[model samples]
Target: MSSFDNTHITALTDLINKAVQDIIAEYASAGRAVPSLDTLESGLFQVPEETPARLTKAIQIVEAACAQLSCTVAPPGSVMINKSLEHEEPACLLVVTEARIADLLLDKPEGLPASELASRSGLDTRKLTRILRLLATKHCFKEVKPGVFANNRLSMKLLSSDTVSSIVCLLTDESLRASAYLNETLTDPSERDGGIPFIRATGYPFFDYHKTRQGLKKGERFPRAMVGWGDVTGKGLLAKVYPWTSQPANTTICDVGGGNGHVTMNLMKAHPHIKVVVQDQPQVIEMAQKFWAKEYPGAMEKERVQFIPFDFFKDAAVQGCDFYYIRSILRDWPDTESELILKNVRQAMKQGSRVIIHDTVLRDAVRTPESSSNASVHHDVAPEPLLPNYGVARVRTYELDMTMMNLLNSQMRTLPEFIELGKRCGLRFEKLYEVGETDLVEFSPI
Candidate 1:
């Protein structure tokens, strides 16, 4: 690997040019205009599925190259200064999202003045100006003049109607509060509940908090927020990554803890031949049934997909499923509970059965990634001087890791860690699928 110096500048430039040209060619072929930074239509932040894969990689490379170069040449205190001001960004977002400032500015093409905005929103004018200006500098909003703000594409997406806004509020509010207590959990082992920070901050486990949280029917928001987050960060990777096309006509997949069965809905929509049984708690299953009834009536009526209530901790009643799929479930518990969840799924398997686990498979900066050792798991490691695990490019890996610890005293696992846990329940490693922010590993009876 080359040092982080100008010696690699030409190579970076060439890579950037190639990706740019490739993207332009695709747009030209499609008879579409190349999108600009001023517009949200072209960016990769929360792209639609119809976007071309090569273009996504191209945009990512451009951002990574620019960021890597900027960091390398940055003077002392650059990193530390960034760390110190981190809280301010989330605070700014929390204010705007909660206050519905984005919605207020949405249709005002001429831009909204600060004083008027404050009057309408019932916020103090001076305080609101400071908050909006901070985010406008980062392209989230546009400061048309000294004290006027307008909704740009990024900010427009945060309108009160958007679910991503709810996610932003949730992460930066309760989740953020819980994150501040991580050290308390790590060090104060003797303090009650083994220092689980989410429980410490919210007085309820993460899932329980979602179930009992009161608001605009808080029960519905958590699942909807999850789908929004998955779209923004992951692009519904589970829907895209699996080889659903290859599944046999009779293939059956049991979606364990599949809240509202959104993932299964996507799968059934894409691959009609694959049958699915989505399981969750009784209440969540009720929600899923209503969802399927409204959104995918055919799938439910045809019996190609259905929602069933299953408590993951109990012995399995689901039998003869070709694939038992779990997503974002295990990371909500420590190992002992996680093992029990696996053992229950184990009890229902027959020959040719496989369990597909969809969650984050964290890679260490120093250790070789499991993808290198397993032909089945495919992912992109950062090129050249960038960290192999994508460094700052994928810091969400660690962010979610902390969130897991804060909420449940659980963890995102390394391959070896996952293997060890699976082994405890008479399951063996079968294969792995590297989805976006998460991984899908298949395990079978030893």
Candidate 2:
């Protein structure tokens, strides 16, 4: 009959106020305007920063409360029922992209008629009108005038040249295939033998499928899409969060499996004094070279960055770097392969060297509250009466965990699991830098 109890409501109020003040103060200090929901750019999420960890945690806590409380107050089927058809949003998007409707709308901010959009893209006018109307219902595109379309912030990402378009393409393409066969993959011997649903649906494991001459372009699209995903989702905040300057001057930091050096290049750009090595498979290394030369000419010209071909299982990691940094790398493999990769890094380390691992550390279903005395090592927990790990706010991480499972037969890991694996390679967990759902853990030589 009543809303949440006094304690829960009070906590939510405090968290909301704290987050508001902190965000305002953070921006004001930098002489910038704080974000607002009315503007699309401001409405986006960012990876949290330790400089304002308390503020970041406050934001996560209150947002989770908002979602949970809103739903809790409503009847079961009211808000929850429609989510069953969430896939239709993407299904509609597949049509938008295939027809390049977004591209056609890009220059027509005033809006272009559905008939003209159809003519340019070669779809039937009536069919294109229905599809755009479907998307416009969800605000993906705006119907500026009846039966006319234009790019709004949401639809802009689907433009032909936008990196986020690549992300949209990859997930819908991959996730749709995997979802269809996921049930079969679990019980069918042949499907299980294929290793994952992506393999079963597409006739190859995710990576191997990407490398086929046909797969090469889509394979490349996924990484570039990651760059966009990082931008939108706040995965790019590491350059600011990491204590890069703590290392001595001229220190070397090796980016293991650094695809196209997107993350590594950000680090090099931000911390100019450090040297970076971008290592990956030979093909990726070649691409990384071109990426650096094109985007960060100063890095190669000044000898501050190097690209080297590498295979983690077969060779020792680039030797004697002060730091070995792995971002979004280890989760692609299961523990056994993960161990071998770490052992290689272990062999490369000098006496005082460390490894910086940037990955999601899965939390317990029920967790020690962040306010608890025992929570120093725990990931952030949701306030009770909401799921402990924050329910839908954390949907993306769980989705990613499944993405790893579906494509690679791997997963996101727990901190204890990380500890167990680290012990096998003689490394000790040194510290955890918490920022939203992701944690950057430092590992030192045993």
**Candidate number with greatest TM-score:** 1
lDDT per residue for candidate 1 within 294-362, as digits (tens), equals 999998788888667888898584888999988888887789999999999989999888888888898
Report the backbone clash tally of model 2: 1
What's the lDDT for candidate 2?
0.77
Output the worst ten-in-a-row residue range by lDDT, candidate 2: 36-45
- Off by more than 4 A, model 2: 1-63, 77-80, 107-110, 189-193, 211-217, 293-302, 369-388, 435-437
TM-score of each: 0.89, 0.83
Model 2 agreement with the true structure over 104-190: per-residue lDDT tens digits: 776677889999988998889998889899888887888888998887777877877777787788777777767767778898865
**Which residues of candidate 1, in runs, are more than 4 Å off?**
1-5, 8-18, 40-48, 207-220, 234-239, 367-373
Instruction: Report lDDT (CA) for all predictions.
Output: 0.78, 0.77
TM-score for candidate 2: 0.83
